[model samples]
Target: MELWERKLKECFGSAVVDKPKAINNEMPGLPRYVSEYLLGFFCEGEITKENLKETNDYIHEHRIDAREKEVFKKDLLLKGSLKLIDKFKVKINLTKKKEDTIQMEIPSLGISDAKVSSDILQSNDRLLIDGLWGMGEIVYNEDNKQIQLEKFKPFQLSEIDLEELIEMREQFSSDQWLNIMVSTVGLNYENYNRRQKLILLSRLIPMVENNIFMMEFGRPGTGKTYAYENISSYSRVISGSQVTEAQLFYNLTTKQDGLLVQYDVLLFDEIDKIKKTGIDEKVKNKLYQYLASGKFDRGEVEKVSECGIMMVGNLPPGGFSEEELLERLLHSSITHSAFLDRLAGVVPGWELESLKDRRKAYTKHYGFAADYFSEIIHKLRKKNYNYILNRISLEGTTIRDADAINKIISGMIKLVYPNGELTDEELKEIVDIAISYRQFVINQNFMINKDPELKRTISYLIYE
Candidate 1:
């Protein structure tokens, strides 16, 4: 192993960091959190071939038997439930109090109502009820269909201790922290140059920020969709073809809040797949309105959800340079410049290094483990790194550039300085990468639209 990998192994260890199929997207059709919790809790903190096999064998040997179905018919059956904990979209129930009943969707099992306690609802964001099954109030109920939850514990990631967090923040240097973060997200620091690494981290920035919007357009095989899909359970990625207002904002059919309310990061993969008019004008307007200010109404319900939105698409590299591509895109109605302008930063997708080029890279050291780093990023969203941007003084820049600078700086806060501590020089290093992202959004628009007036507004966006 290289010195850094060896040092990381010694420092973090397998106990603190374990590979799970969930966070890596090695498993399909299940949420990342669900798979990770099962792996960590059941697989004994190792993700090797031997550990996985042994764990699977053990589970089959001890799982609930089919014969027990009769025994689970009476009393408060301790059945399965999916709880969003304190996190949820509200349903206005005139007859019942807000805390009394919440819907839990189990794929194999049917949805059930639990007469829940405030304590039970406040425990975790999402959980899979496990081990044994019973009926109402922990016993089998023949007549009542409701399942009462009796026992539960939050995963190591969802739970936090203030003293321990402060201690860890003080214990590690920023570089060490960055290296750990990279490895934890399943990347090897040895394989990437600084630029590739930054771009990789950029894909994750959406997950760590609230209400931030980003767009990345490039050729296929650049890992844009792969990055968003595997990173966290809180992300909801969809192909743009089937999107509708009901799906994006609220589902009139299900009488439920849409994807935005359920997830922390909403990713639209291959946006070019959706026709220009396929997205209703109302839906598009609502999205940009919420992007500008975090408020929207679905049916009779008006609510606010904090999530970062990411849009990805492919553009042919050879047909036209970005300058001409922008003109073609604007005129064709594939996407309007007005809608594109809503994005905080537009990623220059061609700049990212492809996964095929970096396939040989692997990390020898352990990081924070996949799920733990995800939870850490979620917690960091509550922090304000605006102070770092406030310290910056720029000359002859429009307010849009200023906003871009702030949002990009906020991304750094979530990824690099989650503990809200960093030196000025360290902040500057992050700022250089951030400014480049902002510059792309501004320069591309000016070049495509020939907005001489707009060009003058972003004189400071250019970096030589």
Candidate 2:
């Protein structure tokens, strides 16, 4: 164990300072001392400089144990040989307090039991969902917690199995609203867990609600393509630069009639590169109709109404302002046409480049779990999940463009949560995210409109 610890420190260098709680917390789940030791090293040493400094400062301020967590490593190897693995199993006993709140304990750890308020647990599940690897794998655990919370609490509980959960989700309440439901009522998982569920739900809900084509648009590394590529074997993502109408929907040239087949998802990477006449007329017309109605006629054969469409692309650097980003590109191409309307949803991409070290990698567990859920959600979609949103209300919801936006939100929720079981709180949050996205678009468009100064700019005038 000592040897392994030394090796890990050597591996990461000076960033591997002693932080006992993190070391102790991770020790049990790791199989060998080597893994735990390396984890500590990675957590400390490989961390970004800011994180390294922050954690170091935190350890010092808290007077945390600075001694090499080498003893914990030795205990791991020695205990493994003794077949005392049971000793390492952390028994997390959680008792229900108020409705949706919990009191948790693990006597063996000699720590005072703690309580999680209903508000805390009920906070947006996405908050819990993070890009971190292990943290995002807690959805199943959260699902389990839902059942336990209902059984133990002496309060009225909503009967929500995965089915009802789906029903609520189909409401299309709004990203913010759905986030709230998932956060408070939905089981809280880590970010990876949340992302997995979000990816699956995002794809599945649309199929269940409208079976209309959907596209995820954003810059690179946002996992837009990853979702279609890795989540389900049934889905396919192809480069927009290379795909032709025939290859995408129908291959009439082949003996098998070109395998003219509809798919669950047909994701287009680099949609901005799609060739068009006059940046709008011919190109926008073809793509727009196909996206909205799923109909397209090529040279020899025509394929109509066959698959869901997801288009992803990168916005130019400092591309117009946020509001103008999507609008500027669209207006430049075609000027507010049907192509924009056919889009069921648009995932807003974060602007700043995520710190390279802050980025996460796909793990075996995340991949498998996501794949499994994708199957489940796909199967469930066959059951018909759609709702109608006639009315919704939220506090302090004043806005410059309430009428049109509210209608869109309501319509989407109806599409998303068909059973009409969406809660008041869930509705509020979804509206928030939805409104934020719309605001982003509108504001960005305003900036682009004001860019008359760029009318003479070479790049602005150059057609893609």
Candidate 3:
């Protein structure tokens, strides 16, 4: 075993899994976390053929395929009930006056009008929002021709020891910890250089920090959307879809909160296509306001959300100047200085190679199980690391720029130095990277709008 892999296993133990084995046995239509959860449960060390077969058999029996929805329904009817592991959500039918208006939706089974008990909904209120992955029993009620959700157990780690995680970080060097994290995200650390690895880690900033608006534009197949989609259930990805004010913010008719309020990170994948699908002007206005501040007002509803906004899309095929790249990649509605300034950082995804080109891009070594790693990241979000900013002073930056830089620096500190221990050189390196990220936005802003106010250089002095 490699040195880093041995260190990871020593530090994390059962919390780690063979990432490549998990990927190899990945079930179609299931997130990485779900599959890794099973792998970690069944296989403590290496994934043997016997254990793999058992895991695959369990998935085959529990997970319903899209094409087999009708078959499953018939079986449910004949058996009077069926149990499966799937995403279960509840939809409130306010228009209906009957008590049966609270309905359940099993997307995999194509059943939207299933019945659910008040007790179940009360305990798992998260189902009311975007729902959650869980093992649920559906009963076919002959008297009413209704499918009822009889029981449920959420498919997530109940709790994580945040202090234990922070203490474990002391066991590994900074480089080793970085490698472990990259592998946990299912990437081969050897395939990426130091800067490329840092960019990949930067993607987790939104997951760990609050109200961090960022964008990443690069070539297609660069795995830009991979982390958000597979890393945690706390984030939602909207790709190649039109976003409405009601769906993103709040629905006045249903009086239900939208994706922005429900998720920690709301990512817009293939963001360039969102423009073609057409977004409402009101949605854009509210989005801009929310990006600037975490609060938005719509009709009689005024609410605050700490959800971070992240946009990832592909740049045009041909190479262009930095100014043209920004103008072309960003939707015209949000290409102005106002919206650009709200972003904490802009990752140059073009610097990283596509996973398509690298055969060994996926890590074959052991790393934290996806469920455990996700829970760690979710818990990290509640932490306040802004105190790390006390060690630095900004020069020649507006209040917004400094704030953005501080957020990036704090986020990096949370990811790399969660124990709050760092040498002078380590702190300087993080500060430089943070400045460059914000400076990328500033340079593009000045070039596109030719605004002298946006052209100022951003530099920082480290306090001894």
Candidate 4:
């Protein structure tokens, strides 16, 4: 094992695992967190061939593919009852007057309207929200032709000590902690230089902070979407060209809250293509409003959410300047100065290396288990580090610019020094990166609009 891996294991113990070996390529449909949880449970200690085979066999038997829905249903009918591992959610049918209105959706088995007992619902309240992934037992009532969920056991980590996680930061130096974070996200720390690593870490600012609007555009296959998709279940990735205000904010017809209210982070991947589907002016206006102040109004409903927004896309392979790349890659609706100014930071994804060869880019060392790491990030969002901003001064920056820079600094501190501990030099380094990120947006806005007002210099000073 590597030195860093040994240190991580010594500190975190069972919370860490061999990240590369946690998933089997053959079992492709399961999410990274689910795969890691099962792997960690079955293949404890040194993962051997026997353990791997046993894990794979269990997954194959329990994981029901959409294509195998009919087969599983047939078996359930013959056996009178079935127990399987799947994600199931409860939907209360307000329209139904009967007591059997509490329905369960077993997504994997393609079964909707399965009756769920009130006891199960009380035990797993999460089922009413985004649902829970775990073992579920379903029995068929032949007379009524209804399926009932009798039992459930969630696989996700139910409770985490945020204080303990914060305390653990004291065990490593800043550099070592940075490397450990990089590895936690499944990247090989040794493969990236310091600057490149910072750029990668910037992708996580949204995860650690709330209502942070950011964008990253660069070459393809850079693992832009991989981290957001696999790192946490609280984040949702929308890749297609079309995005509606109703889907993002509130749906009037369904009277339901949208993605922004449901997740910690909403990542819009392939942003360049979103313009092709045509985002109308109304949607753009609503998006800008929400980005500015985490609140949106639709008809009679007005709600506030803390979900962060991240936009990511690929720049066509060429020698175009950064200004030209921004012009071509940004969605048409958000190209104006007003929309650009709301962004807290803009990551230069071009600086990061590609993940074309998984063997070369992915980490082989021990790192935090996916579910555990995700929970830590989710919990970190509740921490307030804006108080640290009082020690720094910004010159010649507008309110928006200062707010944007402060958020980045706060997020950086939260990620690196969650225990609220840092040196003067460390604070300076974080401030410099934060300013540069916000400056990139300012520079791009000036280049596109040629507005003299956007060209102001933003500098920061740390006060002892």
Which candidate comes out best when scored by TM-score?
Answer: 4
Write candidate 1's Cα lDDT for 74-134 as tens digits. Answer: 2114443322221122233334566543644322223344434446446543442121111
Clashes of 2: 35
Could you tell me every candidate's TM-score relative to the true structure?
A: 0.78, 0.44, 0.94, 0.95
Name the runs in model 3 displaced over 4 angstroms: 92-98, 122-125, 273-279
Candidate 2, residues 1-464: lDDT per residue as tens digits?
23333433444343233333232332323222222233444353443556545544533332213262344334423443111111111112223344423332212222223333344345322112110111110011232332111111111112213454444343333443333322221122234343333442443333333234444455565455644553343455677545544455444453111112435556667766643323334444556656545566655656555455555677765644554556534435533423343444455544323213322232211011222333433444454212323344332222323432444354444434545555665555456545554444344433545543312211001011
Name the 10 consecutive residues with the lowest summed lDDT in model 1: 128-137
lDDT by residue (tens digit), candidate 4, 1-464? 86767878987777888877773332477678877877777877867889878988987888887889899999989988998888898877666668656778998878778998889899887787667788888999888898999988777777878898788788888888888888888888888888787788889899988889998987888888888988787888998657787888888775657888888898988887765665777778888898888898989899999999888988776655876666777665777899889988888898876777878888867778888888899888989876678999999899999988988888888888999899998889889999999988898888887889998889877887
Per-prediction CA RMSD (Å): 5.7, 20.4, 2.1, 1.9
**lDDT (CA) for every model shown?**
0.59, 0.38, 0.83, 0.83
Better of 2 and 4 by lDDT: 4
| Candidate 3 local lDDT, residue 362 | 87
Q: Which 10 residues in a row give candidate 4 its minimum summed lDDT? A: 22-31
Candidates sorted on TM-score, descending: 4, 3, 1, 2
Better of 1 and 4 by TM-score: 4
Ranking by lDDT: 3, 4, 1, 2
